[model samples]
Target: MADIKPYTIAIDEERLNDLKTRLSLAKFPDELDEAGWDMGSPLADVKRFVKYWQESYDWRKAEAELNSVPHFVTDIQCDGFEPLAIHFIHVRSKVKGAIPLLFMHGWPGHFQEVLKVLKPLTEDGDGVNYPAFDIVAPSLPNFGFSEGPKKRGFASEQYAETMNKLMLKLGYKEYVTQGGDWGCHISRALAHLYPQYCKATHLNFNSANPPSYFTNPILALQHAILPYTSREQRGVGRSKWFDEQGRGYNSEQCTKPQTLGYALADSPVALLAWIYEKLHDWTDSYPWTEEEVCTWISIYWFSTAGPAASVRIYYETTQNVDGRKNKLDHQGLRAWSPGVKLGFSHFPMDIQVQPSTWVRTLGNVVFEKEHESGGHFATWERPDDIITDVREMFGKGGGAFGVVKDATGYAS
Candidate 1:
């Protein structure tokens, strides 16, 4: 606890003036009259947001709202990498045996995603019927207020190390995880690498390959025997659409993040458009206000490591750097991670909406739920969906019940 200290959101006055100057002098690009969202974030929407952001948005109000939550910062030094200052939100339930839950966020999303569900998750629950959790949501390295690793080859392994160590530092010897996007990847890596410490996981983004006969024979047999349900067929179509059309950002970030970083770092409009596009496209049409958009973009604009630092996670994990490949590859994450209890929540409009059969192949899937609606950012879009699933999964009679040693997630 000596190494961890209380944290607050404090963007400098100079930075606020700088952002205003950039917005005032921003340039706009010509758009196709009827393009809509087919090409990218519409020019009209961008211009409107720009005008609102420059004139009416209040950073001080937004900053105060964010600081209302309990936050802390600590130094975490991964093997062979310099110590980086990690920022996290920590909320401890009054319930003595409440489960420890580590909530992670992915690219284009910050630790703020936990805000909606924070109260419900950490509140006291009935001893025998409902459950409570001690929530720890951290801004991953190179994201939000957290410092980024300066050295190369800091991939999934380093991330898992950072998260695992964070939990251990908090005295959570055993815990479960919930995440989407890069959070999904990092949580899977935690299960794969530190099964003893990470007892279970509940993921919203179910990105996995089909079960192969050689690897998962039971799942493979089921995959072959079952007919594709209409929902699964639609999900597959969605997956294909993402692969063929929605992955231009992936390609660019994985190959040349530095080149793109220039645009994102220099121009506030460019950063807004780049992230705002995903916020629009990835959600289940969640109604977004201009103030909400500005606050979301402002976190990245005024991040400790800067907006440009975040994208390197994609490049570092996918491509070999400094003559060393990532310790935990993406394909390895898709494979079965034994001994770790697994749960998944499938949202129809998610970026890669895979079949339940495909997701089950990843681990010992003790629980699964399919939602009628929701998208990539389930935490923000449908907090109730995640809250229900987590309570059901770890509550009494659930498959993963009591997975975390004596932590039954209820009052003593």
Candidate 2:
């Protein structure tokens, strides 16, 4: 608590002016006639966003609303990386023993995803019906308002360490976590590295490998014996589509983020188009209002570490430039990590839509549910679903019920 400080999101007026100037000079690339999303963010769409961003969108309103949440900053120093001033939202429940829950966001997502579920989760509840939670949602290093590490090799382990330390600093000796995308990976790292503290986890994204006989005997048997359900088959198709068609951004971010950083840093429109493509492609057709789109882009445009620094997470985590074992490497993190209880929510349109059996191999899966809609941004696209799954996972009779010792997440 000594190192923690209250914080607010105040983008400087000069930075706002600079963004407007950049938007004014934004250059547009040509698109073929009727080129609907196949090529990229439609030129017409980008043009519309630019016009809205300059003329109609209001950052001050967004900023004021964002500041209404309880924001805080603290310096979390991971081993071998410089100390980073991590920005987070922490809201406590009035329940006597509310469970501490860490909500993590991945690339292209900021701390905003937590707002939808934050209040609902922290509301006081009877132990038998609903479980309350103390939510801690952090902007990962190099993303949102969190400071970027100056050194390289700040991979998943470092991110997990930063998060774990943040929780411990805030006096949460044991906690649960929920996340998607890179959030899924970091939660795995925490479970593996600090199982005693990271009591349980719930994931919306499936970045799992096929079940192997040695690692997951029961799941492997099920995988080999059972025929693919229609849902599983459709999920495989979605996964294939993502690998083949939608992974160009992943390849570039993993291999050469610095090369792309210039465009993201120099031109606000370039940053918008780059991320807006994913916003359009990744979700389950959730209609994004103009204000919503502008605010999401503005978070990147006016981020404390600058937008370019955010992409480095992809490169640092994927490439073994130093040839270390890298326990937190993306592939390694996907492997089984026992001890912590697990819950999963499967959304059809997510990037890596593995079968339920595949993800079960990752840990002691206690609960799971499948939904027909939603995409990569499950927390945002389907917050109600996320909230329901979490409540059911930790509520009375749930598989992970009372896992966090005294924290039953209810009023006395």
Clashes of each: 0, 0
Tell me model 2's lDDT, rounded to 2 decimals.
Answer: 0.88
lDDT of 1 by residue, 1-412 (tens): 6778999989999999999999999999998779888699999999999999999999999999999999999999999999999999998888766889999999999999999999998885864568889999999999999999999889998999999998888888899999999999999999888999999999999879998889888888998999887768889888888898799999999999999999999999999999999999888889999989999999999999999999999998888743553457788778789999999998988999888889988889999988889999999999999999999999999988888885533211
Question: Which residue pairs come into collision in candidate 1?
Answer: none
Identify the candidate with maximal lDDT.
1
By summed lDDT, the worst window of 10 consecutive residues in model 1 runs over 403-412
Estimate the TM-score of every prediction. Answer: 0.97, 0.97
Error of 1 at 171 (Å): 0.9
**lDDT tens readout by residue for model 2, 1-412:** 5568889899888988888888888888988888889788999889999999998889999999999988999898988777889999989898766889999999899899999999899985665557988999999999999999988788877888899998888888899999998889899999989998999999998978888888788889999999988879999999998988899999999999999999999998899999999998889998998999999999998888999999998898887735654557867887788899999999998888899888887889999999989998988898999999999999988988898874532111
Residue 188, model 2, lDDT: 93
- The C-alpha lDDT values of all candidates are 0.90, 0.88
